[model samples]
Target: MTTTVRQILQKKNIQKIITVSPEQSILEALGLMAEKDISAVLVTEGERLVGIFTERDYARKVVLKGRTSKDTKVGELMTQNLLTVSPSHTVDDVMQIMTDNRFRHLPVVEKGVLMGIVTIGDAVKTVIDQQAETIKALSGYISGEMSI
Candidate 1:
């Protein structure tokens, strides 16, 4: 059986997604992210996901460029070109994409609607869980063989 995004979503307890408007200052977004203890926040315009603002974006675009976070708009520093996945996508599929793109988070979309977000930590944990289950099954099989 394949692990799907839906399965992961079912396991997650917190469904609150932090969002920021493109017109908002980077400092404001950062404040929300800090308060939530999240590394990234979706840049939305009335439910439309326009971009993503992350810590990396802050480091490279704002800090490196000497742009003040209090004055810069999130849209100016956000990553506009995004890579997203659907609810039906397998964990392996998303793992590959995250690895290939060096992405820490991937937004989950369904029929052009944003559903949730998955992090690299989540994907790696899922893979580890799958491996542990496989190992347990193999160990059970070996024990049964020994007894037979």
Candidate 2:
């Protein structure tokens, strides 16, 4: 059996979905991210996901372009072409998507509703945990402690 996004989310025990309005100042969004110790913030408009803002966006789009965060709207810099994943997606599936796209964060959506967010760290942790479990099972079988 493969680990699913739902399982990952449950394990993560996400308590809140941190979001910001598209019209909000980039500085405000960055402040929220800093307060939450997160690298990304979901951009929404009345419960509708519009885009996503990340630290990379600020570094490349704002600082490099000489645009002030306080003077710019998140919508102006947020990545509009989002690649989302569903709860049924496997950890490997998401990892592949992230790897191919160079994404550090991915939003979880179910039936057009934003469910949660998954970070690259989450996927890597899941993979590592799964590998450990496999190793443990193999050891148990080799020791004749469990049936194959």
Highest lDDT among the candidates is held by which one? 2
Instruction: Give all TM-scores, in the order shown.
Output: 0.93, 0.97
Candidate 2 off by > 4 Å = none
Best by TM-score: 2
lDDT of 2 by residue, 1-148 (tens): 6899999999999888999998999999999999999999999998889999999999999999999999999999999979999999999999999999988899999999999999999999999999999999999999999976
Q: Score residue 106 of candidate 1 by CA lDDT.
A: 91
Q: What is the lDDT of residue 77 in candidate 2?
A: 95
In candidate 2, position 58 carries an lDDT of 96
**Which consecutive 10 residues in model 1 have the weakest lDDT in total?**
139-148
lDDT per residue (tens digit) for residues 6-123 in model 1:
7887777656777899999999999999999999999889988888999999999999999999999998889987899998999999999998998898988888888888888888
